[model samples]
Target: MAFCPICNGFEEIKIACSSCGNALMDNGRIMDYYDDYSPYMPIDQMKMEDGYPADYENRECPHLLKCAVCGMNVVRLIKE
Candidate 1:
């Protein structure tokens, strides 16, 4: 996990991308997984060389990060 270059606060924030404080509008609303309203493309397990979703069911998901320096929320492209 990456840290904020400035305050280093919210290091374990839900968003995978770094963020700035300003982007945070309210509490408990940082654009979580269920927020993704886009179409879902199923992942093919057979083609995966390695067993995907390692401990997925139990693993905690990553969330967005707010930048302490610029105070803007950033987005991250997640990989499976």
Candidate 2:
């Protein structure tokens, strides 16, 4: 779940969207979901002793970054 910056309400949300009655933003322009996220785990140093591959993959995000795939407004670093 994420918090709405305007109303400060908690709700499930998406990374891309627009608001209908947003005071500052256009109705449905571009919104975001600020939730817990994480980058991929490094392959080299990881090990099964920690648990298992699936456990690592299913771990709650340690951090989250924006998708550079389309350039949505996010905090993630984009590398070329």
Candidate 3:
């Protein structure tokens, strides 16, 4: 549901790697990964009330975009 600023086209809310020009996968919020460490927590415990975090639109909790093709990665500060 995100658009590319450079191409003005709808993209998968992720950016391609600059070095490899390969599309990146949207791995979601950074906090979600940290929440996975709890031994007693449910697997789905990190679900958000909204589709995204409250501060996500304000460029907090950046999205982690990873490129499987070339191992290049980037952190994008997204705004809804």
RMSD of each: 10.9, 13.9, 8.1
**Reference-based TM-score, model 3:** 0.51
Clash statistics: count for each candidate:
13, 3, 0
Evaluated against the true structure, the overall lDDT of model 3 is 0.54
Residues 1-80, model 2: lDDT tens digits = 32223233332224442233222211210111221221133322232223234433443211132333433332211111
* Model 2: colliding residue pairs: 18-28, 37-63, 38-63
TM-score of every model versus the real structure: 0.24, 0.15, 0.51
TM-score of 1: 0.24
lDDT of 1 by residue, 1-80 (tens): 32222123334334322343244322221222333531132222211322334323333222344555566654332322
Whole-structure CA lDDT of model 2: 0.26
Highest TM-score against the true fold, candidate: 3
Tens-digit lDDT track of model 3 for 1-80: 44323223343574668888888877765445564463244323332432445543443335568898988766665554
User: What local lDDT score does residue 68 receive in model 1, on the 0 to 100 scale?
Assistant: 53
Better of 1 and 2 by TM-score: 1
Q: Quote the lDDT for 57 in model 3.
A: 47
Q: How does residue 14 of candidate 3 score in lDDT? A: 46
Report the alpha-carbon TM-score of model 2 versus the true structure.
0.15
lDDT to native, each model: 0.32, 0.26, 0.54
Q: In lDDT terms, which candidate is top?
A: 3
